[model samples]
Target: MHVPDGFIDAPVSVAAGVVAAGAVAVSLRGARRELGGERAGPIGGERTAPLAGLVAAFVFAVQMLNFPVAAGTSGHLLGGALAAILVGPYTGVLCVSVVLLMQGVLFADGGLTALGVNIVLMGIVTVLVAWGVFRGLTALLPRTRRSVVVASFVAALLSVPASAAAFVLLYALGGVTEVPLGSVLAAMVGVHVLIGIGEALITALTVSAVLAVRPDLVYGARGLAAPLKLRVGGELVDAPAAEPAPAPARSPRRVWIGGLVASLVLAGFVSFYASANPDGLERVASDKGFDKSVEEHHTADSPLADYGVADITNARLSGGLAGVIGVGATVVVGTGVFYAVRRRRTGSGDGAGSTGGGDRDTAGSSA
Candidate 1:
């Protein structure tokens, strides 16, 4: 849920800003490893950085398609689990953070003053929790594609409510209104539970789809399904490891193009059918009487405010154009950020001598 300005006091917001900044800084360093630097070996090393950018744009586009949850309430994809499953957790945090920033600055969907709160809840908390749950479940369950898909669902399902709980904790700390803490917690958790189901389905389906085509690109699915074993004379022995084959040059390119197309279709047209009702957080805030504390977004007059073009007369066209622009902008900005991170990592590794190969191997194995 996008927290508007004035919901939390200035001091708490600034504190959250510091926390968000620190998390982002940590994530950037971690992302250098996840993006695989300039190494050229692992199943998807060269592709991870570009794919991470596409993942961010895709998340931005999908967040526009809010589906109906309970009556008069809607919820959209949070993208943390999906991104973490596809890319890595550190990059997933960056992906959601990019989306939140775009939403706040361009669409005015979330408030500028509350940007830190949104990043903490939707970016850091969701990514960390979902990644933890996904890793735990994947470790416990069978190492199969189905297991990965199942884990993705459960991870996504739990992440939403965890984010809600985090928000509740924040509100308790710096809430501007007088609502009872217990009521707010209960309502936030209850509604987000329903929202989480929708999130799980979206995450599972997307992960499944990607795994079907390019399982190597799925960060969570790596090293899953242990190497086969064979029986020789008497006892069973592990099968000989396959020789490492160079990755095809065009595979990731095709996947990237396909993903971009899907994002365009979803945001440019499909979003028009999204439910018009208030989303889970908005509904919960209204029901609990705390919504009255929300202040108007300072960027309310922007050309793309509220996901619509400022001068377009047709509702459908205006929103669709804005969605397309958002996707384009996010992809451009995200790609630049990720590529820069990757390059920095590459430059550092290059300066460090021959040890770069071992480090690349380690990063690939972990990724």
Candidate 2:
């Protein structure tokens, strides 16, 4: 959930900011490793860059449409497990960070003063918990496609409550208002449990879709397969067998366009059907008296507040336009950041006594 300003004290917020910065820093380096090696290809890079942006925009849109879970309480996409499953964990952290940044600066969904705390609670903690659980389950469970799906479900389910617990712990340490610790803990955990189910389902479905299409691209699926071997004349061969030809690399433009269109439809159209209830954090805050201290966001007058166009009067058209714009902006910003990271990595590779390229040439002739 997006924590607003004044919920936590100044020192706690600053500490969270420091943690957020470190998380982002670590993510940048991890993203480099995750993007490097055999996985490093032009098309894969193209796909990942825009995919990261789409993730940020998608999470942003989904967060706006809260579905009612109980009286005065609702749930939305926390997006930790979804991003980690679809992309690598490091990139997932960046994706959530981007969404948080946009929400604070553009839409006023979260507070500017408490930005770091929000990122720490929502971005770093969620990603860490989800990834940790996912990895643990995968290791223990039977190695199969079904195991991956189940792991995704468990990981996502656990992440939400884990985040809520973290919030309670933070509040205990530095809450501005004096509230009963037991009440805060119980309330946060209870509501977020419902929210976690929604998170699990969404994460499972998204991971399944990606696995079906490109299991190779899923970091969790890496090395799960036995080495490819084929029988010839009743004897097994040591050499790996070639599979059917791979489909041609689809243009990045097509994938980007399709993702943008899907995001717009979900945010602009389906969002209209979303339950009109305060999300889990809001409900809990109101019930727990935490809402009393919240300061009005500085960007309350932002044109895109509540996900509508600045001047457009048509409800459908305004929201649709806003979704499209958000998708475009996220893609541009995300792509720029990743490209810089990739370029820097490439330069580092070259400076270390070789060409900037990462791999050693195995080909006998130039293509």
Candidate 3:
């Protein structure tokens, strides 16, 4: 949920900004490792970086499709679990952060002043909690595709309420209105529970879809299946592993193109059917009488404000065009950031003589 400008006191907002900044810094470092093939598989820096960018754009598009949750309330994908499962936790945090930044600056949906608050809740908190839960569940469950999908669902479901609790804690410290702490917590948590179910379904479905096509690309699904074995005479023995094949050059490109097409379609056309009711946070704020504290967004007059084009007369066409533009912008910016991080990692490896020219060639071809 996006916190508006005046919802939190300036002191608390500034403090949250510091926390958000630290989280992003840490994630950037962590993402380097993940994208560099140190955390998942061999085709990393090249493949994972572009996939992460696509994930960010996909999240941005999906977040626009709000589904009805409860009476007069709707909920959309938070995308932390989906991103973490497909990419990695660090990159997942960055993905959501990118979406939030785009929403605030271009769509004028989230507040610019309270941007830190939104990042803390939707980006950092969601990624950390969801990743933890997913990892824990995967450890306990069978190592299979089904298990990973199950873990994704549970992780996504819990992450939503966890984020809501974080917001409640923040409000307890810096709320601008006189709403009772207990009432606020109850309302936020209760409504968000319904929203969590939707989040769970979306995360599970997306993870499952990706796994069916390209399980190697799914970070959370890595090592889920044991290596192949051979039966020699009467005894079973570990099969002699074949040399690692250089990743096919066009596999990631195919996936990226497919994901981008889906994102464009979802944002440009499917979003028109999204429920018009207030989302979980907005509904909770209104019910608790704290919505009065919200200040108008400074970017209210932006060309793409509120997910609509400024001059388009048709509501559907205006919103559709804005959504397409948002997806395009998010993909470009996200790709640039991830590629920069990937390059930094490669540069460091080169300086240390840790990566050979062959490895670099493989990575480049895969990209």
Q: Top TM-score: which candidate number? A: 1
- Please write out the lDDT profile of model 1 over residues 1-367, one tens digit for every residue: 8999989999999999999999999998888777864322254455566788899999999999999988899999889889877888888899999989989999998889999999999999899999999999999998899999999999999999999999999999999998898988998999999999999999999999988998877889887877788999998998999996765644588889999999999999999999999999999999999999999999999999999999899999999999999999999889888888777665566344434554454343433
Displacement of residue 320 (Cα, Å) in model 2 is: 3.2
Return the candidate ranking by TM-score, descending: 1, 3, 2
TM-scores for all predictions: 0.93, 0.87, 0.92
RMSD of each: 2.8, 4.1, 3.2
Off by over 4 Å in 1: 37-46, 231-237, 240-250, 350-367
Model 2, 1-367: lDDT tens digits are 8889989999998898998999999988777655543453334443466666676777776776678878867899888787876667888898889888887877778898889988888888899999999999988887777889999999999999999999888888778999898988898899999999998988788778767766665667665665555699998776656784755655556545666777777776777678778888888889888899999898888998767788889987887777666666766777677766655555565234435353431111111
Candidate 1 local Cα displacement, residue 287, angstroms: 0.8
Clashes per candidate, residues 3 or more apart or on different chains: 0, 0, 0
Local error of candidate 2 at residue 325 (angstroms): 2.1
Candidate 3: give its CA RMSD in angstroms.
Answer: 3.2
Model 2, 269: alpha-carbon shift in Å?
1.8
- The model with the greater lDDT, 1 or 2, is 1
| Candidate 2 lDDT score at position 149 | 90
